[model samples]
Target: MRVAFVSLETVSHRDTETNQRFQTVLEILAARGHDVHCYCATFWDDERATLERDGITYHGIATGLEARRSFLIRLPFVLAASSPDIVHVHAQPPAAVLAASWGATLARAPLVTEWYGDGGIDDNRWTRLAANRGARILTPSELVATWIRERGADGDRVETIPNPVDLERVRDVPPGERVDVIYARRLDEGANLESLLLALAELRDRDWQTTIIGDGPERAMYERLASDLRIDDRISFAGDCSLEERIAAYRGAHVFAQTAEHCVFPTEMLWALASGCVGIVEYHVDSSAHELVEGWDRGFRTTSEAELADAILAAGDLEHRTFDDRFADYDRSAIAEAYLEQYRTLEEAYGLL
Candidate 1:
């Protein structure tokens, strides 16, 4: 199978959630023996026409992000010549999807766009038109699927495909030093660490340790808040540890707290949950974190910080395990298979199979 990806800038340009997800998708296809090509602005040194790395061919569509308009103008002609089985685009700069629609038509291929709504895409007239252009729309969460549908994409065409995780890593990495509870997220305003902090403050009388695993612009403030609460000694400020380090902490902890006020997809929480932590998510209108724990027996969904505190305490009763198969459906291979199914269905629908 040959897939042509349309994105003016990729992870090489910047490591954003949107860019990273698309990169993972492209690599997954390449690793599985599918011929993959990405049309993007040149990020490597020199003005190379194409660069091949790791079984994926990247055709430079423009010089840099500044040439995005030119990228749009030249995409259709370039893609038409490539004649790929499918045209997969990153739906960020809205106009890119509109331009890719033209490319998909010229190539006589199915147009698929992956939209990560947490990137602050607006629902203006142009984006609305762009949304309707894709043969299929993929989102990281149903919360984002709702956003895409509202932006003019057909509800039937919007599919909720989550960010994939490596379950093997979860099961293999040994657990970090034991802690009673764990909370991980960038220590920014949206982190809502206070929800957990205040709850912890309320339970100062109890004997439990917490490992807060992230660092950001607001780390100092979160640390200050922890200090002011006088529970700083029991809390470990493990500023921005690596993936293996995070998984280890999650494995060691008995409960994982998801208190962020906004999230398109709770990647960290998912990782922690897969590491066998009992998930406790606080419900927020803008965040779909609670969506992950709604019906799960080993998880709790709360509406307030007080309730979140109670859930953490209640989680102590659950049997502790270092690893969990709770989220096997979200593994990378599983998600790749999901995409392969979409590819097959779309190809058959277009009679290209």
Candidate 2:
């Protein structure tokens, strides 16, 4: 099968979960003998050079003030030349959806758009129209699938396929000396790191250290908050780690805390869980973190600072646990097969099979 993937950027960035997911799927499809072509924006100097890797070809679209105009003008011609069987687009940047839709029509191929639960789409008519233009829409969680449906997408066309995790890379590492409590997320206003600091402050009597991973515009603010709360000494701000470093942090930690609100199936949380860290999420009205711990014994959903502190204090008891089968379905291989099934279905429906 010939597949064309459209996104704002390629996985060469490797900075976000969305890019990683696309990279994984491309590798999987390419390994399975599918001709995969990725069309994405070129932001950095290195991104301007086109190349082929892992049996997949990547074409970087132009970037600048006229990027949208350039992409819209060039994409249809490129798609027509490639003549792909299906065009799979990551739905964001709004312009990508519009351009990909047009390009897919020109190529006479099925269009499949994916929403990675970034909260960029709402009930706006234009957003709904772009989303509904796809022959199928894919989301990373049930919460996101529901959101798309409410925004006027057909329920039958929307499917939930969780982000794939590299299970072998994330699981069962030998723990370091200290039993660390870890919180990893963008240290921005929405991260709600302040709540985690307050909760940790409440447990001053407990003998546990925290390592906060990740960086954002509000990193300095979070650092000051930790100082003002007098817990700065107990916390370490290990900003933006490599994939290996992140897995090591998760494996070394005895407990992992999540305080972000409205997160849609955070891949970090999944990594921590798969690394055998005891999971605890501070409850929020719209938080999807609770879904990770819904029926798990080693996980907890705390409603208050005191409750969170208690959960942390109790995390030591869970140290004996190892990565289990709870998240087996999210393994990269399993997710790749799921995507292949979807692609085959679309091919059959389009009479390309």
Candidate 3:
């Protein structure tokens, strides 16, 4: 099958979650002998205008003052030239939606819009119209699928497909001695790291240490908060880390703590689980962290600071479990097959099979 993916940026220049997810799916489909072509922004001058890597073809579009104008003008022609069986657009930068829709229509191919549930859409008229234009809407979680449906997309057109993880890459590493309680998310306002700091402060007398991973705009603010809370000495900030470093952090952690107000199936949390860390989520009305750890022996959900501290302490007592069947569904291969099934279904429905 010939597939065309439209996105604002490619993983070559940016390593965001959305880009990673799309690249994973593209690579898997390409491995299966499907022709996958990605049309994305040329984020860097050094990046080639057109290149092929890992069986996937990438076409980098122009960027700058007239980026949108150039993209809109070129997209349709590009799609016509590719003549893809299906057009899959990563839905974000809402501006790109109309171009993708236009390109798909021009190519007379089924349009599948993939959304990451990143809180960019808010029932806006244009966003809704763009979403409704898709032949199918793919979201990373049920929460996101429901959001799209409420925003004027037909319920039947929306589907939930969780992001895939390379389970073996995260789980097969040499196990390190678990010690510190770890929090591995961007140190941004939305992360709600203050809550975790306050919770840890309450357990000052406890023997456990804290390791804060990842970096962002609010790193200095979080560092200040830790100092003000008088827990700075017991906490270490590891900054932004590579994938291998992340896996090592998860393996060496006694507890994986999350205090985010919202998350769409965090990849780090999944890695933590795969690495056998005890999972503890701070409950929030909109957060889905609880869903990942719920029903596991070492999984916990805390509603208050005291409860969070208690949960962290309790996690230290629990033993790390082996990588079992609970995470099989999240494996990259499994997720790839699921996406292929969706593509096949769409082909049959559109009479392309």
Candidate 4:
């Protein structure tokens, strides 16, 4: 299939969960012999209009990410010239998606939008119009799907496709040193690590150790909070570790706690779960973290420090595991096929097949 993806800024321009998700998925599809092309503002060093990387081709619609108006103005004509079989566009900067719609129309292709709730569509004017022009919308979680629907997308036109992890990678890495608890994510304003710190403070009398993975500007603040709670001694802040290091930590840890203020998808939680850690998530009004743990025996959802602390203790009863095979359903290959399935469905429905 010839797939044309539209994004004003891709992972290269600004790394976000949504952009990285599409990059991984599209690269996977491209590796499988599909003709995948991403149309976005250029990030490559050269003046090349097109660049190839990770099995997919990239077409620069504008000079840089800052050229939003230029990207929108020139995107349709560029995509139309390419004439792909299906057009995939990002939900962010809804203007880009709307422009891609015109290009899709010119190429007689179906337009699909992916909205991860990371950004954009807050105003809703373009979101609604983007949906009006696109064939369908894909989201990482139902929380995001509901968000798009509330903004004026048809319920039937929006679908939930969870974020995926490279499960094979998880299975290959050996477990690291054993730890009692784990929390992973960029320590930003939404880190909410204090909640977990408070929970751990309450359990200070217990025998346990912790490893806080990832780093950000607020790392010092979280460390201070942990110190204020008198649990800093037990917490180790491993700054910005690699994927293997993270997977090892998750595999060795008995419990993984997620207390973020908000996230469209619990990506790290999924990795920890697949690595065999008991998943514990604290719910937030803007967060969809609870969705990942709703129905699983190894998962726990709590809303308070008291509950989170208690769940950590309760997880001790469960046997430790190095890995869980169930999450294979959310592996990269599964997600790649899901994307193709969505594309094929659109093709059949729109008579594009």
Each model's lDDT comes to: 0.89, 0.80, 0.80, 0.88
lDDT by residue for model 3 (164-272), tens: 7778786666655455688888888798988889999999987878888889999999999999989999899989988788777788887888888988766788888
Q: Identify the candidate with maximal lDDT.
A: 1
Q: Is candidate 1 or candidate 4 better by lDDT?
A: 1
Model 1 spans > 4 angstroms off: none
Q: List ranges where model 3 is wrong by over 4 Å.
A: 12-15, 43-49, 61-65, 322-325
True lDDT of residue 81, candidate 2: 77
**lDDT for predicted candidate 3 compared with the true structure:** 0.80
Q: Residue 158 of model 4: what lDDT?
A: 84
The Cα error of candidate 2 at residue 23, in Å, is 3.7
Instruction: Give the alpha carbon lDDT tens digit for every residue of 1-353 in model 2.
Output: 89999876666654666666667778878877888988876645664446677798878666732476787678777877789998998776656787888999889899998887564356676677776768889988777777778777888899888777778766645544355589999877789888789999997777778999999999999999889888898899999987778777787778889999868777889888887788999987556678788888899999888898888878777654446567888888888888888888988998888
Best by TM-score: 1
220-289 per-residue lDDT for model 4 (tens digits):
9998888988888999999998999999999999999999988899899999999999999999988888
State how far residue 213 of model 1 sits from its true place (Å). 1.0
| lDDT winner between candidates 2 and 3 | 3
Instruction: Sort by TM-score, best first.
Output: 1, 4, 3, 2
Q: Where in model 2 is the C-alpha error above 4 Å?
A: 11-17, 42-50, 60-65, 171-173, 285-287
TM-score of 3: 0.89
